[model samples]
Target: MNPKELALKAITDVFVRKDITAFDKYFSKDYKQHNPFIPNGTEALKQFLPTLPKNFKYEPGVITDHGNMVMIHGRYENWNGKNMIAVDIFKIEDGKLVEHWDVMQEEVLPSQSANGNAMFPII
Candidate 1:
């Protein structure tokens, strides 16, 4: 699969559809996560997903594909009200996601922005 397709499948299958087994199909065995709080392995994420609140949602907006890597901009709406705007980068090797990095900021409302525009263009 191409990098963008791999990224979409990884997030949509696992986080959106709640299909944990998709990790085995989309992620490499040596997958490395750069997010500090999460451990560095596919197995770690597999173990963590079920622990998330039922209301947690990942809504992807814009995607930038660059050959072997893809960057996704999205919203992570969790049950705790810590909605975040995030940029997730995935590196693909041989059709599998092998490395990941992410940066997130709390989503700002239109009222909070000087220009009154929401952080997510899709919303």
Candidate 2:
């Protein structure tokens, strides 16, 4: 699959579907994670997944690609009891996701925004 397709599928499988097999299927064995709260490597991610609240949900929005990197804008619900908007970046190598980074913020309601604009664009 292309980098964008692989990234979207990986994110959906791991975060949305909570499918543990996705770690093996889409992640490199030495996957490097830049999310400070999570340890480096796919194995660590596998161990971390189940600890999230059962109501956790991931909703993907816009996706962009450049060379081997893919960036996805999405929302996370019930993440530590707060909704979040995030831009997740993935580096793909050899058809597997080899690294990741993300910038995230607590989601604010549209009514709370001064400009009345959504953090995530309509997809």
Candidate 3:
């Protein structure tokens, strides 16, 4: 799969579907994570996934690819009792994800925004 497709599938399988096998399929053994809350490596992610609240949900939005990197803008619902908006960036190599980075913030309701702009596009 292309980098974008790989990224989407990886996120869907691991985060949305909670498929542990997806880690071996989509990620390199030495996968590097920039998220401080999670340790480096696919095994660490596998362990982390099951600890999430059962109501946790991931909603992917706009996605873009540049070279071997893919960036997905998404929302995490019921994450630690609050919703979050995040941009997840993945680096693909040899048909697998080698590295990841993310920037996340608590999602604010549209009504709370001074300009009333949504964090994610309204598509």
Candidate 4:
């Protein structure tokens, strides 16, 4: 898969579907994570996945590609009704995701945004 497709599938599997088994297929063995709360490798994710709140949900929005790097924007809806808009960046090498970084913000009302639209991409 190209970088964008690789990122989309990887993110959708792990985040949207909440499946860690997909990790081996999509991630490089040396996968490095930049999420502060998470540890350094794919194995850490395997350990952490189940700890996530079961009610949390991830819905992907737009995906952008930059050669070996891809970024995906999505919504993370938690159990308490609090929602977050997040952008996750992945670096792909040899068709496997090798590194990742992410940024997230709490979802806000349209009035709270300067353009009166949600943070996620409309497309």
Residue-pair clashes per prediction, in order, are: 0, 0, 0, 0
Model 1 C-alpha lDDT per residue in residues 2-96, reported as the tens digit of each score: 78877998988887887889989998998988999888778878887888788899888899998898999988888256999999999999989
Write the candidate numbers in order of decreasing lDDT: 2, 3, 1, 4
**What would the per-residue lDDT of candidate 2 be over residues 1-123, giving only the tens digit for each residue?**
999999999999999999999999999989998999888887777888899898899999999999999999999999989999999999999999999999999988889998888887664
lDDT of each residue in 27-52, candidate 4, tens digit only:
99888989997777788788867777
lDDT of 3 by residue, 1-123 (tens): 999999999999988998999999999998999999888987777788899999899999999999999999999998889999999999999999999999999998889999888897557
User: Rank by TM-score, descending?
Assistant: 3, 2, 1, 4
RMSD values, in order shown: 1.5, 1.1, 1.0, 2.0
The residue ranges of model 1 lying beyond 4 angstroms of the native Cα positions read none
Q: Which stretches of candidate 3 lie over 4 Å from their true place?
A: none
Model 4's TM-score against the true structure: 0.87
Candidates' TM-scores? 0.92, 0.94, 0.95, 0.87
Q: Which lDDT values do the candidates have, in the order given?
A: 0.87, 0.93, 0.93, 0.85
- The model with the greatest TM-score is 3
- In candidate 3, the residue pairs with backbone N, CA or C atoms under 3 Å apart (3 or more residues apart, or in different chains) clash, namely none
Better of 1 and 2 by TM-score: 2
Candidate 2 residue runs with Cα over 4 Å from true position: none
